[model samples]
Target chain A: NAGVTQTPKFRILKIGQSMTLQCTQDMNHNYMYWYRQDPGMGLKLIYYSVGAGITDKGEVPNGYNVSRSTTEDFPLRLELAAPSQTSVYFCASRGTGPNTGELFFGEGSRLTVL
Target chain B: AQSVAQPEDQVNVAEGNPLTVKCTYSVSGNPYLFWYVQYPNRGLQFLLKYITGDNLVKGSYGFEAEFNKSQTSFHLKKPSALVSDSALYFCAVRGGGSQGNLIFGKGTKLSVKP
Candidate 1:
């Protein structure tokens, strides 16, 4: 299984531009999440979806949006990019069972904003 | 607020010696703690988790962690470090029983010198 996959491994954007970082998981997981990794800042949650058609804002949700149309896809949208948005983005998923707390992560997408 | 902290920015250890990466967390109730590793320019990989049961949790790549409830810490350890063990390690905790709301610490870079 492809566990989790993220598109556009690397991207560059100018301030105010917009784009979507696509993420898909084949694990049939009920929970999916988006996280941004900045140097010395660790990983901050941006958004997450419990299931299809259910999404919620995370700790660092400002400037980002997300939609979960199907169980397999959870895409992150940057409406108006800024320099602060330049970071490595990762998508992750995990099962709903009480014992399944560990997350399976994607390869990550590197974004650079000017 | 739920949070995770890796006290050391970097840990240096000699090959064949033991190593420990310290992590502490703050959250209400029993926390679901996890450890993940990331190589340079790569995504995070699951290492271990502590949800319930035994306080000592073993995970991938021959790594183990002890969950100290009183201390609210999960320290990753290895009996014998290897050069290949050099990477960025992260500690995380589930936030408020939400839908996969995981909070991560500023990663600790592990360096094993030969």
Candidate 2:
């Protein structure tokens, strides 16, 4: 399987600009998540979706928005981007099952807000 | 709230020697723990996870972790380190009772010197 894939490997956004980070998984996972990793810091959760049409806020979801319109796609949107939003973004997906907590992550999209 | 901690910011070990990266966690109930490794400028890759069963779980690339419930620790270990193993390692945890968010540690950088 292709597992998880993310588009726009790198980007630079002007302050207040908006953009969407695309993510897709071929594993048919029910859970998808977005996370941001700052320099020398652990990844902080941004948003997640348990299934299509079911999105939820995560620990650091304040400046981000997400939508899971299809079973294979979960896109993270950053509106009014700020310098603080400069970080590496990762998308992950995991299949359904009681003990299926194993997450498959994408290649990541590095963004810098200037 | 659940959280993960990696006590060391960086760990240095010589090639062919044993290496260990310590991790500890805090949560109310049973925990689902995981380990991921990230190479320079690359996204995190799943190594292994411990949801239940054996205390010692082996994972990718000759890596293994011991899950100690009483001590609330899951330290990554490898018998003989390789220079290729030098990378950033992160520990993550999520509570078992609910679909709690996965929490991650600050991350530990391992440098295997020849």
Candidate 3:
């Protein structure tokens, strides 16, 4: 199985532009997350979905939106991208379990806002 | 709130030597901790996790972590470091059982030199 896959591995956007980072998982996991990593900083959660049609704000959700349209897809959208939003974005998924399961991550997408 | 800490920003070790990456966490309830690794421009890969039964959790690629509840730490260890093992390491934690959210620490960059 492909586990998790992310599209648009790299992108550069002009300030105020909008873009979507796509994520898909074949594992049929019920948990999906979006995170961004900055140099020397920990991964910050952007948004998350417990299942299809459910989404919630995470630690760092101010500039992004997320939608879980199906069990296999969780996409993050950046609206009016700003320079502060430039970072490496990662998508991850896990099975629904009592104990936290290991997260399977996509390769990641690097975005730069100019 | 659950949180994690990687006290070190970077660690340098010689090939074939034992290496340790320190991690500590705080949570209201029982803690479920995890370790992940990331190569340059890649997504985070699961290394190991501590759920309950055993204090020592073994995971992929000859990596292991010791869960010290008294100390509130879960440190990653490798018996013999390999140059290829060089990467960025992250420590994460979540409240046990039914808590789907995770808290991540600032990552530590590990460099193994031959």
Q: In candidate 3, how many Å is residue B4 off?
A: 0.9
Error of 1 at A88 (Å): 0.7
Weakest 10 consecutive residues of candidate 2 chain A by summed lDDT? A94-103
DockQ, 0 to 1 scale, candidate 1: 0.87
Best by DockQ, which number?
1
Q: lDDT-based ranking, best first?
A: 1, 2, 3
What global local distance difference test value does model 3 have?
0.91
| DockQ-best of 1 and 2 | 1
Residue runs of model 3 more than 4 Å from their true location after superposition: A98-100, B95-99
The TM-score measured for candidate 1 stands at: 0.97
| Per-residue lDDT of candidate 1, residues B45-67 (tens digit) | 99999999999999999999999
* Clashing pairs in model 1, backbone N/Cα/C closer than 3 A: none
Model 2 Cα lDDT, one tens digit per residue, B18-113: 999999999877888999999988888989999999999999999999999899999999999999999999999974434445778999999999
